[model samples]
Target: MTRGERALLISVDAGSSVPPYEQLRGQLAEMIGDGRLPVGTRLPTVRQLAADLNLAANTVARAYRELESAGLLQTRGRHGTFVAPGRDDAMDRLHRVATDYAAEARRLGVPPAAALALVRAALDATRPG
Candidate 1:
C-alpha cells in the first residue's frame, strides 16, 4: 500500500483500546521515527483525519496538538500539519521492544509473517478475555 493509504488505515483503527488521540500520537511518532512519513511530509488536516477516521474533529485536533507539543509534528499557519524533524525518545523504547521481539523470534525460528501475526493477535486480544 502507498504510505498515505496505510496511514489512513491506521487512523481508522483509532477506536481501539488506546484512546484515539494516543493511538494517533503513537502511530505518527513511529512513522516519523521510521522515516515512513518523512520530515516535512504534510499530514491530513484535523478535519480530514476526523472525517476519514469517523472521529470528532476535536479529537483529531487534540492528538495533533499533543504531537505538536511533543515536537513530532508542526503546524504552519494555513499550510497544515507536517512531520517534525528529530528523534523522540519514544523511538528508543520502540527499538528496544523490537529488538527483544526479534531476538525471541530468532530463537524460536518464528517466521517474520508469523511473528507479525502474533503481534496483531495480541493487539486484538487486549480486551477483557
Candidate 2:
C-alpha cells in the first residue's frame, strides 16, 4: 500500500490520555519499524495529513519535526518528506562504509559521478551470474 494510505490507517482517540500528535508519531514510527512504511516512502504534506486526520496543521507538523530530529524522516526541499533509511546496525555499517568510500574519493579528488560509477561497477560485478 502507498505511504499515505498506510499513514491514514493511524487514528487518534480523543478520549485517551495520550495526545494526538504523540499518537500519530507512535503509529507512524511503528509502521516504519515494522516495514509497513519502508525507507524512501514519501509522507503526505503536513496540511494534507492534517486535513485527512481532522487535526491542526501544527499537530502533524510537530510529529514530523520530532521524527526528523530522531532521524526517522528527512525533508528534501520541494521534494517533500521521506522515511529515512533504516537505523539498524546493518544499515549503520553500510552507511559507515559508504561514508568512508566518499571520504577516500574526496581525498583522491574523484568527482561524484566517477565515484558513483565505480561503486556501480563493483555492485554489478558482485551480482550472481
Candidate 2: clashing pairs of residues: none
lDDT of 1 at 42: 82
TM-score of 1: 0.59
Among all windows of ten consecutive residues in candidate 2, which has the lowest summed lDDT? 1-10
- Model 1 residue 12 lDDT? 48
Candidate 2, superposed: residue stretches over 4 Å from native: 1-7, 90-129
Best model per TM-score: 2
lDDT of 2 at 27: 74
Q: For residue 70, what is the lDDT in candidate 1? A: 69
Off by more than 4 A, model 1 = 1-7, 12-15, 86-129
> Tens-digit lDDT track for model 2 on 1-129?
353434458798887555899779877776666667778888998998998899999999999999898787899978788889757867546645765686688679887689899999999999999
**TM-score for each prediction?**
0.59, 0.63
Local distance difference test values of all predictions, in order: 0.73, 0.80
Q: What is the model-wide C-alpha lDDT for candidate 1?
A: 0.73
